[model samples]
Target: MHNPSSTQVKIVTADPSAIGLFGLAIVTLVASSQKLGLTDGLSLVIPWAIFLGAFAQLFACIHDAKHNNTFGMTAFGAYAFFWFATATSWMVKMGVFGSELAGAVDGKQLGFAFAGYLVFTLFMTIGAMETHKVLFFIFVLIDLLFIGLTFDAFGAPEAFHKLAAFAELGIALLSLYGCGAAVLNTHFGKVFLPVGRPFGIFKARS
Candidate 1:
């Protein structure tokens, strides 16, 4: 009698960073427009915040987790939740969750939140140094963005708000470039766009 044998199958998934960057690009573009006074209200920004900012990055986080990419998972996951919370906060402030919640709003609380994210981004910026120049600069811009946001929330001068607006716009443009590099490089199986080499400061263990 012949015995039956079991076989295991391995699955491969595509890189998720492209989608995550694309999401970041779109949301920041929309939000930065509002910050720069090119747009009117949070009412329009909220939808893109929830859908593209939250959901798209969350999707990337999950897939990165599957790939055992701790860095990608953490970065995408954190930002995804950030957008989710931001969208909800906007809704509450807009009276979508009743006037009681909206009445309790405080700008300083947002300052504290931005401060915390600034710390987070600082360390992440260090990590990005080993990634690639494009990503490293993106993290640097994010650092500037959070710094400006924190100061602006705490009633700093108008210059900080302008700083935040310009930084956010920079992030949007760079992220779009990064997204394009991720996709085109993979699809064409060649370096379609140069993202620059990673800094050789930290080497992987053998």
Candidate 2:
């Protein structure tokens, strides 16, 4: 019989949130490319949804699971599933699935979806803030993304589309930063963030 205390468990010292950050970055950049007409909308959006949104977040969730980080795991895993579902929804809308339900899901229905996502994002954002600065930035970007998505869903018109694009760009930039920070900190095996600085304001109270 193996003694659990004596068993050498290799702790995962690296932050998994980097995956989500980088994933959001890629998603936003590709979305911007589509909005700018640099690429066909469907062509770029599909890859963004699948690779960036789905797989990237899924990778983070897997790492969190390995670390036994319930909060991180739940946050990343839920979003990963959300991305997968939304990706399928996009494919269905593009007529790839041949489902009549896709046709019936207009902008308003999509708006409701965004609203639901925004609620989820809030919960995840709270969790993110408890993690680190890199994660905190990602949460902020997620909040912006949800806001933009909700607005677009409600038929806010073309100007709001630009706002969404900019928000996405912000998400990408912050994601890249978060990714860099995670990689650097992991390699160094040191606490790089300043001591006594709480990622969440509420956490400082405790």
Top model number, TM-score? 1
Model 1's TM-score against the true structure: 0.95
lDDT score of residue 42 within candidate 2: 71
Candidate 2 minimal-lDDT segment of 10 residues:
191-200
Clashing pairs in 2: none
**After superposition, which runs of candidate 2 have C-alpha atoms over 4 Å from their true positions?**
1-14, 36-38, 99-102, 190-196, 204-206
Give per-residue CA lDDT, model 2, range 1-206, as digits (tens).
Answer: 98666667676455777777688678777876776567775755877778887788889888888888888777767777777777787787877877686677687777887788889878877876666666666667767777777888798877766666777777777777767767767777775643233455667634
TM-score of each: 0.95, 0.80
Off by over 4 Å in 1: 1-6, 204-206
Model 1 per-residue lDDT tens digits across residues 1-206: 99999999989999999999999999999999999999898999999999999999999999999999999999999999999999998999999999999999998999999999999999998888888889999999999999999999999999999999999999999999999999999999999999988887886622
Q: Candidate 1: minimum summed lDDT over ten consecutive residues — where?
A: 197-206
Question: For model 1, what is the alpha-carbon lDDT of residue 201?
Answer: 80
Model 1: lDDT equals: 0.96
